[model samples]
Target: MLAELINPYYLQVASFILINIILGVSIYITLSTGQLSLANAGFMGIGAYTSALLTLNFDLPIIGGILAGTLLAGVFGILIGIPTLRLQGVYLAIVTLGFGEVIRVIFVNWESMTKGAVGLSGIPHMGRELLNTLKEFGFDPKILGLQNNQFVFLAIFLILLGVTISIITFFRRQNRSRVGRAFAAIKLDEKAAESMGINITYYKVLAFAQGALVAGFAGALFAHVLAYISPADFAYHRAVEILIFAVFGGSEVIWGPVFGALFLTVMPEVLRFISEYRYMIYGLIIIIMMAVRPQGLIDVNILNWLKLKTSKRRQKHGTSSQKSM
Candidate 1:
């Protein structure tokens, strides 16, 4: 694993985790709002296909392609959510699952561009080739960027990482805001939240849309990071994996998903001996983790924080009682 530390493959792995972080965070938005969403994978597929088609067919700039991919996915997400978010529980999952299937079929049969199930190739590498090409064009790789692939990859990785961190920090703050409380109440009881004047449809669709949008962002990032893509990559299993990470990380905690993404992305590489059975083992481990720490790794790690909060509250209560005495 240490040998891979400086490899471009490591950048590939880091990119995977980064994309998953976005995907996981998107799921967090929905689950935190008390809705189980499944269309995230579909959005990811949309982003991948969108960016690939744009850059490959039209020769669009990499950045432009990524943006277009994200926007297109967000649009599709909003459209799909409008009708499906109204359904509750398993119904929503079924709806999103169906959407994912539809996307897979579209990418498979659309051979004119997507190469029909063969997946897209010759994709522009937004991370590696882009950096190298920039350097070759006489740009000062140092004043402009790094000549080393590792350093360049790290620079781009930092940019993606920063965006993710900023978004998480934003949401963490929002968790204490009025909208966050409303979403929480809605999650606790949709009917009761509506009774209390919350707009159920608005929040529900917003949750799904937000999740889809971020998944799309991750999808675009994934496309550029790998410089190649295939329909198999975004299959139902991919959706399930994202869900597993969200749950395994404690969907409610912002940092939990990040750890989940990182661990899962690197776990198979670490367990190289069981490469063939890695996925199966991943499933087994997820099952065990869920059974053992259902709230997620973050919850387990922050036991001290919870204890501190409880102790402070108890002390405050005791002081109030003493004053009464």
Candidate 2:
């Protein structure tokens, strides 16, 4: 049972979970500012294609591709944000949804570059590429019993997940800062926020661009993990999936989306026994969640309650220790 759990397929699934976590956090950034942008998947496609092309055609290192892809996506985000941030509610969503379709169309038509719907395959795997580079630098993995490609991939995924979480922690901290307050104010009441001397446009655009950058980073990792990507991978449905990750988890806090992504990503695998009705059950679960807890599985109230419990436990433990002393 232990060996089965450690199999390559399971390792790959774990890598995918990490990728979805990044995606969830990315959408959470935009949702934090009350912007319902559906263009994240488009930005993701941009990152995936850019990285794949750079690595496959220009022979760029995986790290270099990742950075380039991330930055380019940010640039596109800024461009898109500036013009579209003026629109509110469904107007903004419709525009962004159109933007995603436009990106998909470009991917499909730009056959010379994107290979159209067929996708660009044979993109170098990050783990394999890193191992080869290490070998070149005289660091042999075979000596460490890391010869299996899956093990190497797992190691890389863990490192990336840690780094991603650390970065998210920083963002969470920033949420408590002035910028975060501004986001909250805007979310609560945009007119009031502006009346309070907040530059609504700047903050809105900033949030959108940040979300794009994060989504792009996730996409770069995703491309290498799958070693292939197509236009269909970043279509409207993909955008909805990313949104669900944030909405299902609760966008009030960063960890909400993380938990959402973790649960949703793994839930299907755990329910594979009922393969015929898996999707039906999945949809039912979501509908139930939406009806029961529209705010999400986690919210401010839950966090506060948990904090209170922890503090009470600590106080009790302190009193017991003092009495024993």
Among the numbered candidates, top lDDT falls to: 2
Each model's TM-score?
0.85, 0.93
Residue pairs of candidate 1 with colliding backbone atoms = 141-145
Q: Give the Å error, residue 282, model 1.
A: 3.5
Q: Which stretches of candidate 2 lie over 4 Å from their true place?
A: 1-6, 314-325
Q: Per-residue lDDT for 167 in model 2?
A: 67
lDDT per residue (tens digit) for residues 1-325 in model 1: 3334656667767767777888888888888887787778889989888988898889898788888988888888789988887788999888888899899888888888688877777788766665667678876545533446766677668778887888788777777788788888998998899999999888777777777878888898888777778888888998898987877878666777777887888888877888798879877888899899878878645856886687789798885332320
The numbered model that scores best in TM-score is 2
Error of 1 at 204 (Å): 1.2
- The TM-score obtained by model 2 is 0.93
Instruction: Provide the overall lDDT of each model, using Cα atoms, as 2-decimal numbers.
Output: 0.80, 0.88
